[model samples]
Target chain A: MTSGLFHVPLWIELVAAATGGIQGALFAAGIRDRRIDVLGVVAIGLTVALGGSLMRDVVLDQLPVVVSSEWYLLVAAAASLLGMALQSVLTRTEWLISLLDAAVMGIFGAIGASKAVAYGAGSLGAVLVGVVAAVGGGVLRDLMANRPISIIHVGTLNAAAAGIGASMLVLLLRIDVPVGIAGPISAVATALLRIAAVHLG
Target chain B: MTSGLFHVPLWIELVAAATGGIQGALFAAGIRDRRIDVLGVVAIGLTVALGGSLMRDVVLDQLPVVVSSEWYLLVAAAASLLGMALQSVLTRTEWLISLLDAAVMGIFGAIGASKAVAYGAGSLGAVLVGVVAAVGGGVLRDLMANRPISIIHVGTLNAAAAGIGASMLVLLLRIDVPVGIAGPISAVATALLRIAAVHLG
Candidate 1:
């Protein structure tokens, strides 16, 4: 669901949305004091799934791809409902959730930076936009849940990892690497860094 | 500033930005444990002054006026610095701050709703946009400070007042009232409601 200017595969966007939705639903369900209903959980999930892309497009001054694409909402809602239904089983698999979160962050970071680059922003600006897009959804989720912002909190590697990936993408593009190749490289590197931090730290 | 599709006087936009800047500076100064430097405080002030407009424009799929206009940043920075310099004096004048805050919220709400209406959004959609615009800055501030969201907190009249003002603006416009008249009436009503709630409650 990227802008028509870019040519990311539809499946990639759907996967990103689904993963974000599942992670967000799990997060909302974990909050005990909020007394959030089913609809609230789904809404939070949708926010997490699309908030980043929405922010990215907003910063780029383009129409929000999420609003125009019906697939995003439908997939996010289904994934969120699935997450809610299997909360007990899914809670036991923390590693999977972490992996999903890391992947979502990485994908969004790559997409955002790429968009900025395409728009002719300087490297630093592209990186900044990418990091914002990477962490925007989680920021919204934490704010809604009244929790400390995860990206700004002590010991969190989110923004750092996102920045590293975005910088790599910018560097690769500068060196004449094709975007299709550069984007995946950036995403994988970011996810690995986040995954390593979580398991090792 | 409203979108190019609509015309709001430049003075009104500047006043709103200045008031928001001052209020934000006062707020950031009140937070004792953050160890926020002068630059941090100014950044917070800018966020409060421009965040709502940025969000409003993003939702409307229009370029953010804050990003495009040099006047907004200049005025907001000057007002924020002025607020910081007058911290002690400003803190003592609680009623004045409250009045300014209410006015800022009202103006932003009216502007946001009018933009939505101008874009041909339905009445309920217009009201939603207005409420989001009115409370967005404060929400961002609270999130940054890691405080409970003020708009959603029990006993707060912010969203309720904004909704009433936005609804009123929509109704007035439907009756063929000029936007200039409708906007001010809505703003005044919202401000009065907020002021009354603070004083009487």
Candidate 2:
């Protein structure tokens, strides 16, 4: 019944999905040993783009937005195709991919936490949901590819960034901040933290 | 709203979860190259046991029964531990594990489809949900172990068995059959089909 509470502008969600889709496709294409065909790449990409939001909705006991919304699959599939087309160029620029990945994670984390809060989950639950939304896609992709889960394995501080951002939003909301203001700030904070972690390491 | 509609006796659900957990743990322990630790084995076991119900609840937009019920985790963990202890003996007898796996899948499929119909999903959706519930655990387990998904890869008619069982249940219910009779019959049909597939192969 808490439908539309977590709805950001369609463009914003599309941007997040596109970035995630592209990143996922690139990641899949990069696997030399794995015989991932075009369909597999697309499936992996869509899974990365939409998996977080799907998990978030499921956890909130709501109909998954990806399944309900008409535009979600179209955008994700198109983005995946674009990513596959540009795999050669995308693979060469690791830094750009990293930056986009961080941004996408931030966007997903903010939306997930906001939705959880709207659905009356506790602060801790909201934070956990946010992290799951941020990294759930990557985990699915890794699983499908038969690789170590990036979040659990030794890798970038993916979960940490999402957690920090989600916690900050929760703190802000507790202090009477509107979700409109809190959401974007949380996303930017997550993105910056992720970028900083990548650079520092 | 349909909270109590799919409520089987607690003991029946427990039996399914315990068997699934034990089978999952045995499967995990058999993977010599994975080196899954105690915690990992337990996690995988719980996933296999509870994952189906969780997915079913999520799809139906209801609170996940495994998370809501206190007994679920305790039973799953205890069964997993028992499985690990019996691994050496279990390994020598692969037939028993396969039989148990088939039964667990059937139980999950029957329950999942029943719940989906209770929540007003269409017949196709119900069947799909049942297949997902049946195979979802194995998929998760395979992912955690960094192995190819068992259902998608060549081996058994996993998804096919679940689909047939779920469809049979849906047909029975539509034809005015009692759920108590329909559920068990569908489950038994699934188990027999799976066993037959394995034996023939």
Pick the lDDT winner.
2
Look at candidate 1 and give me any clashing residue pairs.
none
Off by over 4 Å in 1: A1-51, A58-131, A144-146, A150-201, B1-5, B9-11, B33-43, B58-63, B66-93
What range of 10 consecutive residues in model 2 chain A has the weakest lDDT sum?
A1-10
| Backbone clashes, each candidate | 0, 0
lDDT of 1 at B155: 33
TM score of chain A per candidate: 0.90, 0.91
Residue B16 lDDT in candidate 2 = 78
Model 1 agreement with the true structure over B159-192: per-residue lDDT tens digits: 7898899999989988888899999999999988
Q: Which sections of candidate 2 miss by over 4 Å?
A: A1-22, A33-47, A54-100, A120-129, A143-189, A192-200, B1-22, B25-47, B58-107, B120-132, B139-201
Worst 10 residues of 2 chain B by lDDT: B150-159
Q: How good is the docking of model 2, by CAPRI class?
A: incorrect
